[model samples]
Target: MTKKICWAAAIYPILGLLGGLYYRELTKAEHFAGDTQLSIVHTRLLALGTLVFLIVLVLDKVFTLSATRSFAPFFWVYHAGMLVHGTLTVLGRESGAAIAGIRKPADAKA
Candidate 1:
């Protein structure tokens, strides 16, 4: 169970890295207007996802939380919430851009 928690915690940094790369690409694009929503996605994925996961791992070690069944549910729900939040944020940004007649670079392919 501890190993499972560690593996789950490790996934966040990789996801955050992917988010950072996407944000970096957007920043480098000439026509991509800087959007706070994208930045929020990057920040929350790193800060809330990666950083908080590590913190939780440390707390679990100190408190011996892996022995408890509640930890599994709590862990899954917390990560799910982060995923949902990030997805909704990106969708909201795209929706807002669409409403304002701003075309996302990715939408150009369609």
Candidate 2:
């Protein structure tokens, strides 16, 4: 579905930008001068979500990818996966923030 692919490409950049803004503002508000999983969320969504769909769009033009039955399932599953991953990344950034007091990814290694 060209419409579906176009929508995915269009929507993901918005989501990515929102993620970037959220990470920056939240970290500043908390005075969190440290590495965070949130830092990667924006890029990950841009690349895996938007960029991947754009690739699919190009391929669709040449190969009529939407004619296949698998396209619908793939479109839905891929979006869901990216959405869940972004959500979890955001959630995990604050994990253990309460009891352990700011356990960053780097802090866990030592």
Candidate 3:
């Protein structure tokens, strides 16, 4: 189904982002601290993310479908969303402190 394929292509990035966050945390922990391994995760995420992007792009043509006006294509909406989310996930998991800096100010501080 064209719609299903579209949905899948779109979902991949979101999942990838979650995966990034998990990867980030896993790599940043004291027990798992290792640039080599961290790099590997980063590389994998980018590779997979890019693949997902390509899939969404190409699948549109291959499947001969269009997203509903009400539900815009995931590829378009999630392009940056997924990239940022995934990157942040990886970074946060690996370096929570870095992510903490980006979060909203603590209530006490605010």
Candidate 4:
């Protein structure tokens, strides 16, 4: 799979889950589920995360950027590359925690 898709597969679910949890926390909708309205801020944050990830995916293919290699000759590009990498890492972690919530139950025996 392309890097962007691979990365998004890993990232989007996490964003979804975090968005869910953050929604839950901010709204405390559990006690009264239908009473709480969805927060626009939460939606915006997740969208921003997705947008940043897409940018990273595009850069991965379009540029000669490396996550590790420093390019003092092209300081701006290097800095931008690093920022994208960092954003992806954070999104991936958030996604992971979110995924944990949706996993099937584990059983040792029938």
Candidate 5:
């Protein structure tokens, strides 16, 4: 449980950073002048994803929450939600690309 929580804490911040980069580059490439859903995705991942796991880690340390039978299922379900959100964000980009021609960050010129 400690290991799992630590991994989530580490992975989420990375995802948040990538989401931030994705938002910036994709918007710039598309010449999008208005606010975008992608713009807030990073903050969401950082705030919700990282923070929740940290709190869960501390609680597990104190309460041994993982000793309970339900903990495993709950953990998987919770992480699944985060993955689904990330997947949806990427899907949004793909659909938006079809309409407005979004470019990849790597393909953008320096």
Candidate 6:
């Protein structure tokens, strides 16, 4: 389980690279408009992904969560949620749709 956590943490750099690419694209665009969603994607991938992985690492080291059977399923489910949410965010950003009807009230009016 520790090995799995380490392997999963390895993905942080890749996500960071993707975020950097998104930032560059945002900067190069002629208009700063309609880039909010893209920025959200970049921020979510970098912040959530990295922070979650780090927390997992700390928890595993401090609490030995990897040794428990119950934790295995929870770990997978958490990561799966992250992947699903990240994919949906990217798609929603591209299509300008609210993901799972989750949007601010102001956004709904627009």
Best-fitting candidate, scored by lDDT: 2
Error of 5 at 85 (Å): 5.6
Clashing pairs in 4: 14-95
Candidate 3 lDDT, 38-93, residue by residue in tens: 33344444566557655755756776445546335553553344344445444444
Q: Kindly list the per-residue Cα lDDT of model 4 for residues 12-100, writing each as its tens digit.
A: 55755675576566445344333222333345335645665566556656774435356324323322332333233333322233333
| lDDT by residue for model 1 (1-110), tens | 76766776677777777877875675555345534345555567667777777777888889988778797787776644434433444544433443333434544665
TM-scores, all candidates, are: 0.51, 0.56, 0.35, 0.35, 0.54, 0.49
lDDT of 5 by residue, 1-93 (tens): 799988988898898888788777866666666534556768877888899889989999999998999989987775444344334454444
**lDDT value, candidate 4, whole model:** 0.43
Tens-digit per-residue lDDT, 1-110, candidate 6: 87787776777668767766865564455344432334554555567666877788899999998888898787665434434444444444333333333544334655
Q: Which regions in candidate 2 have their CA more than 4 angstroms from the true location?
A: 21-39, 82-110
Model 4 / residue 15 / CA error / Å: 1.7
Candidate 3: count the clashes: 7
Clashing pairs in 6: none
TM-score of structure candidate 4: 0.35
Error of 5 at 84 (Å): 4.0
Give candidate 6 regions above 4 Å deviation: 19-38, 68-110
RMSD of each: 9.0, 6.6, 10.0, 14.7, 10.0, 5.3
75, model 1: CA deviation in Å?
Answer: 1.2
Query: Model 2 residue 68 lDDT?
Result: 95
Each model's lDDT: 0.61, 0.71, 0.50, 0.43, 0.69, 0.59
Best-to-worst ranking by lDDT: 2, 5, 1, 6, 3, 4
Error of 3 at 81 (Å): 25
User: Among all windows of ten consecutive residues in candidate 3, which has the lowest summed lDDT?
Assistant: 33-42
- Weakest lDDT window of 10 consecutive positions for candidate 6: 92-101
- Most TM-score-accurate candidate: 2
